[model samples]
Target: MNILHLSAVNNWGGGENQIELLCREFKEHYPEVKNQILCKKGKLFHKRLEKTNLKFLTASLAFQMDPRYIRRIISICKKENIDLIHIHDSTALSLAIIADNLADLPPMVFSKKTSFPIRNRKQSLYKYNHPKLKKIFCVSKKTRNVTSEGIQDENKLVTLYHGIDPELQRNLKPGLDLRNFLKIPSERKIIGNIANHIEAKDLQTLVKTANQLINRENRKDFHFVQIGGFEKPRTSSLLQEVKQFGLEEHFSFLGFRENAAALIPQFDISIITSESEGLPQFIYESFFHKIPVISTGVGGISEIITHKINGLLAQAHDHKKLCENILILAENEELIPKFAEISHQMVLQNFTSEIMMEKTLIEYKKILHERL
Candidate 1:
């Protein structure tokens, strides 16, 4: 079967990682199943695709309804004999739906990776519940639940947790020394977060909590490191927030480090304060490194953290509780290893790339068999 994967996002993030991981695994295990990607030209995904052998086509899509891009998809579908279309992001989903309308295309599936509820209003609803969309692969149960509100056919939504390559991160050597470079003292406890600067990440809460911990509590023993690229046009806003909150001494923004995963082991504790999420890739990577997580109990995070069992959790936007949880993890040395051990084993058992690829292939076969 020939599958055409579509992604329109310019930034490289978890969704892009999912595409690369899935396609690579699928190719290795199922060489008979041909896969191709249609991505935005000159974008991060397109650049990364060059590193892989997977066939890809790119266009500078002006918007979701760009007629030229629709025609391009139609052309690719005919040339590649694409049997299935897997839409990976919002713009790509919209483009695929439009392309389907323009031509009698193959069955399409959409991957829902965000836990933010789709606005149940008419147009947004149509985008999600379009007739051409055969299935919606959700990364988390919370994402499925939120998407179900905008979807009429409940059976279409399937919760398939995003899986990481267990072997890829295992035995990863420390690629870089972030601590010494930043001039942070060895005695200072390091708290780390890996997320692209986005609204849903709610990094303001992290800054507020840092302010409370550093300034209000007079806890100068902790250093925070955030590693990710800034969202376009919103880069300096975060710095402004840090300045206003008086967290400059405590917080360090490491912009778009290529070896961010390698440095996770250097952190004393890992944290996430996302207002909304499907399931973050950092948590899984941290699991492989045996780094304890302290995240806001949002999205499918609870499914992993288990509130002080495997890792600690706090409510989103609640700076007080986030601070409390961070301190508890920082101060309790015995609890760290226990939490890290359980979390690490959880990912190894349930969330490996092999398991995810095999299960997803089964679903694809089921859908294609029914269609054929």
Candidate 2:
């Protein structure tokens, strides 16, 4: 089975990480099923793919509906004999649909990695409900449920939780020392977050939460460390807010670190302040690292994290509640290990790359078999 994966995004994030993980899994365990990737040229995903052994092609996407990009997709499908096209993002799906119209291409599968509601527009509905797309693999149950509203054929929406590779997690060496890098004292507890400066991440709330903990609550022993890309407008706004709140010393933003998961070991507690998600990879990574988490109960987060069981939960934008949760972990350090152990066991039992890929392969085979 030859599969071509398409990613239209220009930056590196959790969704991009999943594509790499899926392809790596296929290469190591299911070598019989050959996989290749086609991504936007001159972008971060293309650049990152250069370091890996994965077979890939790049096309210049000058605009959303670039005719040149569509032609390139058609040419590759014919040249490579691609059995299926796994579209990784919404833009890629649009490009694929256009290519399909111009030529009879292979069936397509889309991975809905976010829980954002599909826009109620004619074009959006047409692209999402297009008959060429055989399956829509949602990252979490919440994602699947949200997607079902937009999709005409409910059968295509499948909830497939992407997970961490235990072996990879164990092998990853600690890359950054938070204390040394930030010049923070060893006595200060590190609260770490792995997310880009995007609207969905609600980094403003993160800044507010930090302010509550540091300035309002007068907790001088806690520091916030964020690792992700510095997107424009949002990053600038977040920095200003942090400054305005006098959180300069309390907060540190490490822009876009490769293998950022390695730094999780340095965190006393992990956090996700997203207003929306399809279950961030950081959650699974934190679970594997045995780092207790405090996150907003949005998207599929509540599906995995039982409030006060494996982790603490807060409503989106509720910085006050988030501040309280942080204090809970800091005051009672014993709960840290307890939550970590339970979360770690959960990852081992239900969430692993092996399980995720196996299920994916089953779906792939089923689709191919039905086509045959």
Please name the candidate that would achieve the greatest TM-score relative to the true structure: 2
TM-score for each predicted model, relative to the true structure = 0.96, 0.98
Q: What are the per-residue Cα lDDT tens digits for candidate 1 across 50-167?
A: 9778878898877667777788889999988888999998888778777888789998888899998888687678878887788999998888888888889999999898888877
Q: Which ten residues in a row have the lowest lDDT in candidate 1?
A: 167-176
lDDT values, one for every candidate: 0.86, 0.92
lDDT of 2: 0.92
Task: Compose the digit string of candidate 2's lDDT tens values, residues 1-372.
Answer: 999999888889989988888999999999989999999999999999999999899999989888878998999999989999999999999999989999999998999999998899998999999988999999999999999998899999888999888999889887677899789998789999999888999999999999999999999999999999999988999889989999999899999988899999888889999999999999999999999999999999999999989999999999999999999988888898899999999999888888888889999998999999
Report the C-alpha displacement of residue 83, candidate 2, in angstroms: 0.8
RMSD list, candidates in order: 1.5, 0.9
C-alpha positional error of residue 143 in candidate 1 after TM-score superposition, expressed in Å: 1.3
Summed backbone clashes in each candidate are 0, 0
Overall local distance difference test of candidate 1: 0.86
